[model samples]
Target: MTTRHDLQTRLERGIAALGLQLPAGAVERLLDYQALLARWNATYNLTAIRDPGEMVSRHLVDSLAILPYVQGATLADLGTGPGLPGIPIAIATPEREVLLVDSNGKKVRFLREAIRSLKLENVRAVQSRVEEVEGQFDCVTARAFASLADMLAWGGHLLTKSGIWLAMKGKHPEDELAGVPDGYEVRAIHELHVPDVGGERHLVVLGRTGC
Candidate 1:
């Protein structure tokens, strides 16, 4: 079992090694997140990252790396299983509002618990399908939630006219983008380098054309 201090140290070192600067209080919030995740995962199975050390790379750092790129007012994390990038992002940018939505009751319960435990005033957990939710978010994120095209279609209506759609994908997402509906345009493709993680990670940023 890893202690909280150990996890924090690993997070600090990983962030420094990745050449990423985290927002103040991020470490503490992530620690709380890890605790809540561990507790809920006992039954809810929110995430596979049961070990604290692994949580640093798989959960904390992996989620935080995208912070520098999402410059928007309101953000939504679609299918956020146990609050991946959403909870971390909310903690990082307390001023920016975020919504974490998932269709699973268990996942949403865990997410709500995490929000309460972390005292994350900026995050709201919604237990509904992304397509059914109503809101105009400046940015909407989908992390390992669904295919690129499917996620875009489901979240398209939730984004502001000029908003961006951020999809955190694994290596080789071209297949997912191939079926994208004709409308939005791929604005940027950012390859993420997660500290101490293997394989390839990428971010696909899409933009709507005609509202």
Candidate 2:
């Protein structure tokens, strides 16, 4: 049985390995979010990963790894099932406004509950398809939600002209690079090193051409 203490230790270690300086109480808040997710996941099947330790590494730490690359004050997480990266980012940066968008009603419900329970003043959850979502953000994030081309086609309009799109992938998406739509270009590709997680992790940064 994984106690909350055990999960906290795992998360602390992972955060330390990532060299991240979270806000005071941020670590505990992250663990609280994970615990909430674990409980809800049992009934709603929000995520596939079942192990608590794995959740700390794969979900919490993996999401935080991109914190350094995250830019802008406003962000929209598209297809954010159960608020992966979005919720965690909101918790880490309380000042940044985070919008979590997902088409799944259940997931959005979970997100709302999370927001209420976590006291996340900077986060909001909406149940809507990416294409239907309104308003632009300074930064947009999509985690393994779709192919690069499809994601851009659906949610590209949400990114400001000078904003960036951070796409998380398991491995370097070399083949998908060619499919990037015109007027958008790859700014940089970073190989993220997520602590205690196996397999390759890559963050593909995209933005408007010449921006």
Show where candidate 1 strays beyond 4 Å.
none
lDDT of 2 by residue, 1-211 (tens): 9898998988999889889999999999999999999999999999999899999999999999999989999999999998988998999999999999999999999999999999999999999989999999999999989999999999999999999999999989999999999989999999998889999999999999987
Q: Candidate 2: lDDT over CA atoms?
A: 0.94
CA lDDT of each prediction against the hidden true structure: 0.84, 0.94
Which whole-number lDDT from 0 to 100 does residue 187 have in model 2?
Answer: 95
Clashing pairs in 2: none
Model 1: per-residue Cα lDDT over 90-189, one tens digit each: 8878889999999999888888878887788888999998889998999888889888778877888998988988889889688777777788888888
Mind sharing the TM-score for model 1? 0.94
Give the range where candidate 2 is weakest over 10 consecutive residues by summed lDDT: 9-18
What value does the lDDT take at residue 134 in candidate 2?
95
